[model samples]
Target: MKKAIFLMVLALVFLTPQLSVHADGPDQMIIINKVNNQLYYFDDGTLIRQFPVATGKEDTPTPEGAFTLANKIKNRPWYKENIPGGAANNPLGKRWLGLKVGHNRGHMYGIHGNIRESSIGKYVTNGCIRMHNNDVYWLFNQVAVGTPVIVTRFQGNVEEFAARSGYHVMTWDGEMVDEFQIGRVETLRPMKLYSYNEKGEPIAMQWVPANTRYQVYATDGKGTYTVGSNKYLLYTTPNDTKYELVPSYIKR
Candidate 1:
């Protein structure tokens, strides 16, 4: 009895309450549409994948707003049901990405794995979002703490929805989204700088030394990469066989 009581207390601590919480460079983001029961994942503002999920029922509706993934837990035990972590009967499946919903320390509300695959794409839960165990496993491996998560029922494209949420980055009609630095772009040949205008049109700005690198701020999604608020460079491939382009940094 004492052991059971201790377990219950521990579980209570882990499920204490709710709270709320930005996007950063080349970061991972999660946006869930409560209206459609879908979870969209993005990397650097690019939609990577989406999965069907289950939100809370009417009485225990999932908290809808902007939040951050404050923590991650693996094989979390379902102590309320007396199920051990990693057990077949564990309702939390094998992973948990807890959200900082408002004021609390991201302990209570979360996106977790559900053993019941049929529960996905349906309204069923206390307040958490339910995903397939496999799906959650994949997401858990890709995302990290401090990742931004947006939960809303807004009607718009995911990118636009994220933009309206206030912390994400997205371009409007091929325009540069922001001044945040993407990375450094090296000039493969003699290069010159151009001014990036509000329309994303490149205008001859100034002259810079050839065979030099510059800190890239943004891109127009065509071939034009920006260097500053206005300065940018037109990246192009050369037919020269002497040198080939290769990434200075590779990300998994």
Candidate 2:
């Protein structure tokens, strides 16, 4: 009986899941959405906060891949080229979260505060992700070394996860879009519209009228939606008098 009881206890221990030290921490992951220029903070699979960020420029775009936060620095000085840190002209803002990405573990790319506030929503950085000084300082305090940092071109799965978590849907310009529950249509209306290809350019000038329904499948970074099978661009009139679509959805 004693031997059998001991074996049962060993089996229970083996079957139990071991919690990772990194996963149990409040600040375990940071996801950078390059497409919409946003940074998402997740603590144990829950989103803690999000902030707008500026990524790499066209020529020297921010690296798109997974990385680990290797170091944290307060009032870090910049030393790239001849520029010095702590100077008024220094681009590195108030804090820095260094990243270790790719085979170049020694790479100097990181997430840091920026002096140019206007560059927050634009792709103007030289590889490092740039955030507002105040925002970075707040984030720097939340995370620790070895936290996972994923940089991607699009939000994709993270968007869906955040939506399900009851987070507000926001456009790149910070406009709030209506919350849409899955498997439900918000509003249906009849309207006349023209057809446009996936590129958003007009395909034909002929206007087609039909009753259409709106469902939120995916929204672009600019807060535009392509609804239904024909992929109509959902928009509103300048005066906000009525909602319009590029190509009217006509049912057969």
Candidate 3:
């Protein structure tokens, strides 16, 4: 009995460090939506924060795919093409989150702050994701090294991609909608339609008829709009089915 007890204690000691490390493991996931020019931050499967970002230009498009946050540097020096870091005109803002993108780990691309605050919502970067100085500083402190970062140019809105990718969908009002619902707002032009479940799971993909119209009652930040008193997220008629939002019908 004594020998068994001693072995158990040794095992407990060995497991303690492992448990502690896992207890403090990374709890954040970042998705950079290139199409919408937005950055979404998720903690433990829930979206906790979002920020507008500037992506790469057409000629120098931002690299898309999965990457790991490999390094975090504050006030990093910039010496690209003889442009010194800390210069008034330096593009690197106040913080940098370097990425380990695939086999190219030479610090070629990353997410950083920019001095040009006006460019926050535009696609004007050479390739890196640019954020406001305050925003980057906040993000730098929230995420730790080795966190997972996915940079992708989504085909639709962030909500659609998030639902399709199995991430929890958050409404603009901060409500969590687990089941996927169709958007009901009709667009003047035809658009692709996708259906999803409460857990943000995709159920179907199709195309809507062109020139459809609907009276909008409500909208969810994820591109879902309600129509009529029934509040149907999707409206189907004999000749047409609609889910895309009409920009003019939006309440603002």
Predicted model with the maximum TM-score: 1
TM-score for each predicted model, relative to the true structure: 0.58, 0.53, 0.56
Candidate 2 residue lDDT tens string, 1-252: 000000011112223221112222224567787778989886533456789999999999887655678788776777765555556677888678888766555237989888789999899989899999889989988887877666765434553333222222232112222333121122333333335877879454433333344544454435344455435555433232233322111111
Measured on C-alpha atoms, candidate 3 has an lDDT of 0.62
lDDT of 3 by residue, 193-213 (tens): 455678866444566667755
As for candidate 2, its clashing pairs are 78-85
lDDT of 2 at 9: 14
For model 3, the run of ten residues with the poorest summed lDDT: 1-10
The sequence of per-residue lDDT tens digits that candidate 1 reaches over residues 1-252 is 000000011112223223222524226668898878999886654567789999999999998766788889998888788899889888888898999877876668889998799999999999999999889999998887877777767555565554434323443322333435455555655655776688987677766655665556665555566565535565544421112222211111
lDDT (CA) for every model shown? Answer: 0.66, 0.58, 0.62
- The regions of model 1 sitting more than 4 angstroms off are 1-26, 167-252
Residue 73 in model 1: shift from native, Å? 0.7
